[model samples]
Target: ILHVTLTERRKEYEKAKERDAELRNLRDTAKLQEFFLQEIQLGELWLARGEHKKSIEHLTNAIAVCTDPNKLIEVLEDTLPPHVFEMLVHSIPYTLQV
Candidate 1:
């Protein structure tokens, strides 16, 4: 009976470990997307500095990942820096039309 209990506990531990690994992968994916958002935010800085070409490129890519541009703009607005929000907001109307 003791041996059986130990085997069950080991199985539970292995399952927990597997869950942790999956969670880690999910966390990494979130981090990568956050990095992309940061890039978009940085593009706002470029626009402020009159680097329109690079700014549009980065913003375009960011909007592409956004399945719902309107919803995404709303959700991301408060989280982003003010100028970044400005740029995203400015671009959103055009994206909706497209």
Candidate 2:
């Protein structure tokens, strides 16, 4: 009975560890999403205000953190003007974080 109890406790501890890790991942993902949205929104705001350089900077930051930049780029292509989109493409870092 003691051995069974120990085994059960060990299994429970392992399950708790896995749950903790998963929660941490979820929190990190949420934070990343918040940052990405903030950058994208700021970029759009600057772009609408005709601040090309500032817009590019924020948009570049957004792309840097984005997990799937190609998809984001496609969406941006549709959202931004051709010239602006071209500029953004050039501004992207060679080594993206994601």
Candidate 3:
């Protein structure tokens, strides 16, 4: 019975470890996504002010950090006004040259 209890406990410990690892990965991904969104916003602000260079810098940073381009586009589409989103999309070509 003692051996069986130990085995059960070990199994539980392994499962807990896996859960913890998954949680950590999730937290890290969330942080990255937040940072990406912030960069995009900063880029948009720069673009609005006619600071194209600064806008490109931030947009490039956002693109670099994007793990899922589709999700990034979806978030931008949902969060930004149409004109602002269009400006952002337009800036991408210029960003690639920088």
Best by lDDT: 2
Supply the global lDDT for candidate 3: 0.79
Poorly placed runs, candidate 2 (over 4 Å): 94-98
Clashing pairs in 1: none
Which ranking of candidates, highest TM-score first?
Answer: 2, 3, 1
Clashing pairs in 2: none
For model 3, residues 1-98, the per-residue Cα lDDT tens digits are 99999999999999999999999999999999899889989978987897866776787679767877667667777866676667668776666566
Prediction-by-prediction clash tally:
0, 0, 0
Which residue pairs overlap in candidate 3's backbone? none
Candidate 3 lDDT score at position 6: 100
Candidate with the larger lDDT of 1 and 2: 2
| Model 3 stretches with alpha carbons more than 4 Å out | 68-98
- The global C-alpha lDDT for each of the candidates, from Candidate 1 onward, is 0.72, 0.91, 0.79
Model 1 CA lDDT for position 17 = 100
Task: State model 1's lDDT.
Answer: 0.72
Q: Which candidate wins on TM-score?
A: 2
Question: Each prediction's TM-score against the native?
Answer: 0.51, 0.83, 0.66
RMSD of 1: 6.3
